[model samples]
Target: MEYTEGVVKDKETVIHVHPNDYEKAGNSYLMAIVAVIAGMPLPIINLIASGVYYLGNLKASYFVRWHCIQAILAQTIIIPFNSIAWGWTLSVMLNKTEPTLYYGIYLFAVILLNIIEFVAVINTASRVNKGENVRWIIIAPLTDKLCSKKNKSPYPLY
Candidate 1:
């Protein structure tokens, strides 16, 4: 496996991922998914769960930490869009806001984006669990920037 920019061409980890670490990293993505389902009423809960996973895995190996950050970033991207939709939904239900063509269009867009994100998360989590380092199109660059080799993790990976 060729390592370049913290990514494995096929498979590898700079810090030598433990068998379980792979699962942990993959699970970081899944947590957000679980929260997404359970917290449909409050979309922010998914982000919160992913954030907590990131914090808990702060000391984990680079591979694990990288995946955690990616998961959180994914949630971060959808939160605002989801929030707007949720708020609009609440407003409509409470009869505080009138539904309109614009609202329907916007809600449809948000739901489409959310479904795409959901599929991406599931695919990424599955790959990570199988010991593959998946790089998300947008989230990867940001994660690499935030969790850099320059700022080495304080705790041991093993």
Candidate 2:
């Protein structure tokens, strides 16, 4: 079977993915976005849905696996922030507590962050769909470590 490989040099390793793999990989991110939008009222639902979608794609090709893993990891990082925002909003609603400037600012910031993430996801997916590789400054190391080749140890190394 012939495999397509993306070329990356000079501190970047580009893994090539076929069109099918590219679509599959991009679908993972899209799934996360859908989960977020659909589960907006309940953050836990979003988390579970996104987590399932992300994990389900891990067994794909190197390119797809890396892209999906990165998306999952990025979602994991954002989950806590979302939880905090949701909790604050819920508390304010249940207690009838007046919302403060701080709360407003924080909510605004969270919304901005989410918007940025959504844009990034779309951009990355588009590039990936076009056979272009995308890199995340924050998640790059984790993706590299998780996707790195395992060392061959013939000396019974477990």
Candidate 3:
């Protein structure tokens, strides 16, 4: 294996293990657009649904109970709308008849949206993993010190 920039290439074919940054950035932008177009509706729906649930069912803490209810509401609303939009875009693209300008634009938008979504997910996942590792590193020692102070044990198991 040979390394070029941050990418590892196969010795025989020179195929890169990591994609180029520009490509990744382009994908990330697309993902952000998809998130905005497809995902923006959910938060509003969640707020409404959670508000209703919180008011109707007053047994649990509104803040804590609303989180789960909001997630469910968001999923229910987002999935069906997203699926219909995706299907409509696909059908227009796959149609055998002469494609209209608007159809072409719609197809392009859907493809671009998906690409953007892929990039965003990749970037977010990478950042989250990095952040989580850093957090754990910082937290572990603090947790140990707190536990040790409370229990009078120098070594914390966890």
User: Please, what is the whole-model Cα lDDT of each candidate in the order they appear?
Assistant: 0.82, 0.72, 0.37
lDDT of 3 by residue, 37-64 (tens): 5555343433344345434433332122
Better candidate by lDDT, 2 or 3: 2
List candidate 2 segments past 4 Å from native.
4-16, 148-158
lDDT tens string, model 1, 70-141? 888888889999999999989998999899999999999999998999998899899988888889887788
Q: Can you give the TM-score per candidate against the true fold?
A: 0.85, 0.81, 0.30
Q: Which of the numbered candidates is closest to the native, going by highest lDDT? A: 1
List where candidate 1 sits over 4 angstroms from the true fold: 1-15, 150-158
Candidate 2 achieves a global lDDT of 0.72
Q: Mind giving the per-residue lDDT tens digits that candidate 2 earns over 25-54?
A: 777678777886787776566557656865
Higher-ranked by TM-score: 2 or 3? 2
Question: TM-score order of candidates, best first?
Answer: 1, 2, 3
